[model samples]
Target chain A: MTTTERRLRTAFEDAARTIEPGSLAPLTIPSRRRRGTWTVPVAVAAALAMVLVGATLIGDRMRGGPPPAQALAAGGPQHILAVRAGRAVVEDVTGHRLFEVPRAEGRYRAVAGTAREFFLAVQTTEDTYSFYRVTLGADGAPSRPRKLPGPLFRTQTGFGKPENLAASPDGSKLAVVGTVDGHAQVDVIDVRTGAHRIWRTPEGGAITSATWSQDNRTLGFLWGPKAADLRLLDTRGDGAELEDARVLRGSSIRSRAPGFGLINVFVFNPDGRTLTAQVQGTKTGDHDDTGYVLLPLSASTGEPAGRPVRLPSDSFFVKTDTTGRHLLQIIDGRPGRVEDGRFSWISRAADYDDAAW
Target chain B: MTLFREHQLSLTRTALMIVGDRATAEDVVQDAFAETHRRIGRLTDHDRMLPYVRAAVVNRCRTVLRRRALALRVGRVHEPPVWSAESAAMLGEDRREVFLALRRLPRRQREALVLRYYLDVDDAEIAEVMGISRSTVRSTIARALAALGRQLGENA
Candidate 1:
């Protein structure tokens, strides 16, 4: 080695010796605790139903006029399905609970939905997790929950720790990042047919999150623990080979410095040419240190077309509404609408884990 | 649990190199251990636990750095790394300049140098821990060394 290089290495080694890790406190492992199963009370369900109907009427009267003609033309006001305290509650943009899951059997981990359907990941047993799809009736009431056909996921690391699950905009397909046969696999299931296609990571790195493009033909997901890269897998082709999936070479959302940043949420714009991501900037502090940005990508090359437009900081969760016309974000536990490069709060006191507009 | 007992100290020291503070480094390692414990049942192979925990530590340290960056951007006062008298005496003046310059480098370059010199890991292992390609690791280490050489006024 060169003299200078050797000197540099010696200096680093000397500095590293100053840390005495043995003096740190020992790690404590809590006993394995089981989450209690939840069942919605019959009386509570009836009361909630009454309150929902009453709220609809009261909300209409508060508007000082009839419901918007466009809303009537489109059937009704769009609903946001949010899971709070193990119960999935459907609410409108004004934060009124429309209805809730009846006889909720398990703790709801994560939720994804469309105007017509709601998909929830519920832990039925200590280790068993399953997805349930509840169709919304014309009156905005949810139908009897039906278990979606797929391999059961484990709640070993909470509901959505190492793996993330997302449903297509139309609610026909569900994409999940989970383990299959001792490997980290991405499974795309045709919710109706119960048939699935799986893509396993060759290097054994875990897939953190998955989201379907608006067109429902492509699935975008984040891979790895540190310095996780945003990868795209084309689901249009037959699921015959792993080669069908390719990492977007230059589309890393964070700094290459491992663990400096993370892309928490990403979705394709309605046009399918642009991508919006809730990216945690490479800053060290609290969990709320992240931002939202818009990066236009080349449809053909999968590369970003231009520089990203940074939204507001601390906007951790983002999703587009059903019509894909408006962008919604959760900032400081409240819902906000993003328009004209600004975020305006929509609801006053809403604390939700996930919301689908 | 055994993995924590075996590698916790080494991991903390490695984190200390990246985060440049003993308390944050310890906190980072503790968080990583807690997370690893929570997800331990999902691990397919027990042998991979150390690497997994190591990567988690690095990622947690990055989170700390990220928060620090945001605080600085908003003009918030943050505590600088506290160097003990014993540490200062051991580091001396020339090594202290090098350490300060190391902290000033971009996160990626600093990580590359730490992994290459302090941990003495090769490109392949570094790539796995950093979640990058081996080719990227090679280039990153080379660039980092060149930058360090320039900062130290040494011919590369």
Candidate 2:
């Protein structure tokens, strides 16, 4: 079977296991009079009303309040770096093309960085990814792609290429995460010097969505065999093992009470006290209710801290700017930004594989 | 009654993927069985009884969705079905992504996919269950696979 077919079968089997045979109620057939009668309709109507009222209460309580004003304004992030068909391109907030960052070889799989400074990962081989730095000039012209020397990142096939590059707030350190020999590895590179620090998951796991705290010493990332927990790693610590990283208290995707459903991507705000995450809301039957909220989680506890800003359906990525006022969001491969808690699509097509501001 | 007892769990689980919750799925399966039982005299071909009951379950799920839509239009909206905590625990993150992408598909596409993939039924059976031509089943499954792959960021 193909990957799609395999995934479909796996998903079906997993969902099926939720209803065990032993747990099922006894089967009883309704009589003829019970089916074609007014009494049945009346009973169903009453039951439906009660269920609806209960649902309304739950929805109201979980929806939370409107988002904060300053954090959502549209007028943030002067430029965005996006990867299209393995090449890097620059675009305005409205998604108008400015220019492409010319590369001689390799596909640009991931991107990160902020303001005029940006980093791109060019896949030089099947599993090897080389890093490069690009800086935007005052006139918005991108400087030539400059290769950064150090250990290359490894992105294996089964793990699905994640957001593996994160540039620190001061641009002094670059964190790269990927897998090698089935073990998760993170390499933090010092920009000024070619030296770097390395941390590895000794057993096995896949790491993705790495972000930097303002302190420049704390790196937060999603670690997985399950990849459900968001872990905070101290770069300044002596240990090179990933076990030393602290799993934020409530970061699991399975967090039910006071929790957000699936968080596909997240980034630290400028303050480093909170994280803005794209959360999938409670799903309805056969309805694509994904990407319902961009919620803020307390950095220490992993619990929700503030009101969640609603997002366009299927929005996955979230990039926060330095001021923590503006945000860049990608909905179903189309780039957009949130302003005043409202989402407006950039005029670009939905071809961007990855983008960052 | 024998057939319903034999296949109750499997059929109810199938309905769960279509309707999105356990309780409603069980109800859909039960209603299908009850309707089948009520009209057993008309089922002359024992060989095709399973497919017929499967079709009934699919049809009942469609009705449930239709009623929910109508309720929304008339300003009597119920809470959307959520995967229970147990269901969520059973599904992995990757499988959950697959389910979310599946939900985004059109109703017909979703139906065709569940019939072909989840049911593991052949094209002819899917056509019979969906009340479409065999050729339409093939095409619909093809289109559904491509659309689902695109949404999941993969090439079918």
Candidate 3:
């Protein structure tokens, strides 16, 4: 080899020697064998029965006020999973706690769920966090908490204390936001394979919240403390590549002056074509008196697509259920269902920190 | 499994050169190993295992670089890979400068340089591993060497 080439190889080898081998967990080949074929028929029968019962209960719910407790005993999608008083509680539409975690960890910070499972983010240490995946049983009771891979360090995005983790609609991936080398990043983990992809915010700001699109290809996250705007990152690449990120600044949503407001909470609508955001802004001239408005935004452009729906009360957060049919607003620490352009009281104002359906 | 056990460390070192971070490099190697294991039954030629594993590792490294680039474009702060004090001391200033500058090169150029110089693969092998044409590999390596020379203040 030429002298210069020899030096380059030598330098690389020298650096390579410094890295300790087996620094990552050993790979375990997943078992491909299927187990328990007999249970399938019985499980299928039970699921069909539950669906019939759920449809009946939902029919009753649409007719009038909250359905009786017996109707909610079936434990369907109508129930809200919330973090209240350091506990993970599953409350019915009427705000009655149906199931609660037996041994609650540190206060539950944020939660997201699909039809089959609930993913909870809990603050375990002063600076570290943990995750729990709870599978829902037929009776609507959550099974024993199965801790997911975490002890992930936390990074505050100034958007409030909501744990910045979200699950995809299909529940195949969990996007958890954490700090790496002092920079905030979102790590999208494939739950089945344990394969993960990390996407660090280009601006280095803490991501306040993140939600995946219905297709799971687009990720919408709140970026700012400086240029507080909703940004959409296209995660469509060959397992390892990501398309260029698109910043959605609905022209109407930008503050007359820079840094006048922040898009606090955002979630893609069920249709995946648009989104809803809770915007907190100061009056143009008066920097004092802040107002919160629920604004509909174009999912493609991040611009205000419809008229701003002013919130009646000072709600701290907003979320949509997996079905995208129910919108829950947290006002005075209590969750109320929003329908027909109005907020209807569902659960009494309590010390609930986060909620998901 | 035996192939993995025998050459895992060497494969990891190769990945580390391309990725710059130990943890990420290890993950890349582990995934590549897992992938190689899954496809092991399809390999009719035993001699081709090492080449297959190398290509897998290199491709995984590219995936990581793509993610980093996406994050940077969206205004997310990227923390450059950290090097241990011992490694830094061993590398010294000139080697460290070269290493840092190497990472700054475009992904294709970086891979070409590492494969040619560190792995000591010929242009034909590099083209096969990189999934590019032989002429493309030649041009890429030439351009990479020119860039390196400019960064290092020496004819590479």
Candidate 4:
């Protein structure tokens, strides 16, 4: 063998020795998965199920609850923080530029926060990110950007430099998905104390579309390569491992239906019981006619709970305002509003990559 | 099941070389064994079971690397078994450097080298596990050795 081959063999042996066989846990065989045999029962209950669903819809209408199609457009916030061409600006609901957050080092990449308070992150270096908070005055003028106190984050590489940043509905906590030593990590930071609780991934996978629930403690995110399903992480839990987050298998539209295709973007409705997602394909597998639709999925089971709202065009961004009724959607680079089950263009095409109300 | 029990540790160690961590490696192996057991009724040839499980483990490892998202939740912090500074300390600088260099290789090249050198499997077995021809296995291992040497600043 050559000297290089000898060196490699020795190195491999040394590395293998690090794991002792005695340390391995006993094999825990997985239990057999029982197949469902409920087809006959399901068929028998189909008519009754439809009647019950119709009654529930009528009850919801009588209670004056927002229609599922227009639930996210109920009362939208007026001011928004958006990142456009490396600049962070506060804008009105109509896409009119209101006030620009003062520029510092690095390019602004992400904007997430709610109400009068918002947070943005700047990619200071490749893989490094820093957070800043911008609070809007009553008149909608943005305050000077305040740098958040914390260690700079080593975010995953690529265009979305902030990885995924979501501030709690109350703006009291911030959850940032980043990387530490090449492994994915989620760090939840307390806005008041600047303290951090980190959850580390045991393996590698891209985590995106971070959305906070109404409780301000449950974090919902899309874990991907396939964008399979949305996963939930409890921020208040003491666990420091990402596995502490439960995989909501039902939250995945693709698994819910074979032809659903990929879920491009999703957010938790204010009630935290439904996920509003922009999903591709249709149940009939008619890919040519139907492109994409705004879908509301059960947060727990990923089943479609409401009729899909058709978009004017393909949309990659969707953000719900504090009321959970107001939705701001970006389609083909233009901002629009999804209200009363209809989409109306609200502004000319903008260069913004991300925005939040 | 007996074949899996006999080779579980070695297979996991092989998977660790591909996946860069022990938890995922073990998970990959366990899933592969469970799958093999699930399909045992379909297998009439007993001799092929070991090779089938090895290929399954390797394929599952590839899936884990591709999905790249670790969704498992634990109650405490999970210190990754490799690449971290603390793991580097445990692995020693020489082996750490080698592992790091191995990680930089393409997935196929890295797998080829691991199966050959780490598992000390012959070219035929490497081909069987990797689903490539014996000649391709030899060529891949050769290219991997040269590439690894270049990264390690050594003469191949």
Question: Could you say which candidate leads in DockQ?
Answer: 2
Q: TM-score for every candidate vs. truth?
A: 0.53, 0.59, 0.49, 0.52
lDDT of 2 by residue, B70-113 (tens): 67667895552433334455676677778777775657678888
Looking at model 2, residue A203 earns an lDDT score of: 56
Give the local distance difference test score of model 1. 0.63
Worst window of 10 by summed lDDT in candidate 4 chain A = A281-290
Badly placed stretches (over 4 Å) of model 1 are A1-77, A137-139, A155-163, A179-182, A224-227, A236-244, A251-262, A282-296, A303-316, A331-333, A348-350, B1-19, B22-156
> What order do you get sorting by lDDT, best first?
2, 4, 3, 1
User: With candidate 2 superimposed using the best TM-score fit, by how many Å does residue A200's alpha carbon deviate from the native?
Assistant: 2.2
Please list the Cα RMSD from the true structure of every candidate, rounded to 1 decimal place: 17.2, 12.4, 24.4, 19.6
Candidate 2 per-residue lDDT, tens place, A1-357, comes to 445567788888878887886998877887667455787889999999999999988787788633222222455667778887678898776677889998845888778886558988888888787778899875557899888877665655311134567889888888877656656778898877758888986555446668899898899876643334678999999999987888884333433322436665578899878988766555444332233577788887787777778775645467777778777765545677775566667744766667887
lDDT by residue for model 4 (A1-357), tens: 544467678777776777797888777788887867987788779978999999999999899855222223335576777777689888777777788889967899878877768888888997788888888886678888888887786754333421267888888888876445545567788877778888876664445567788888899875532223467888878778776778776333553433555565678898878988876553221111235678888888777777677776446567887666667876534567776566766666545566777
How many Å off is the CA of B69 in candidate 3? 48
Against the reference, the lDDT scores of all candidates come to: 0.63, 0.72, 0.65, 0.70
- Prediction 1 TM-score vs. true: 0.53
lDDT of 3 by residue, A208-275 (tens): 45788899777776554334346677665533322244667622256332224456567888788888
**Model 1, range A1-357, lDDT digits (tens) per residue?**
433367668777776677654677887776677754434576678899999999998988998744321221153336667666567777666567789877556888677766567788887887677888887765568787888876776533234332267788778898876544334567778988778787764443334457777788688865542234567888877664433566664324443322333444566666777666654444344532334364445545655565554655434356666554566665434556665454566565544545665
Worst 10 residues of 3 chain A by lDDT: A281-290
- For all predictions in the order shown, the interface RMSD in Å is 15.9, 9.8, 21.5, 17.6
* Rank ordering of all candidates by DockQ, starting from the highest: 2, 1, 4, 3
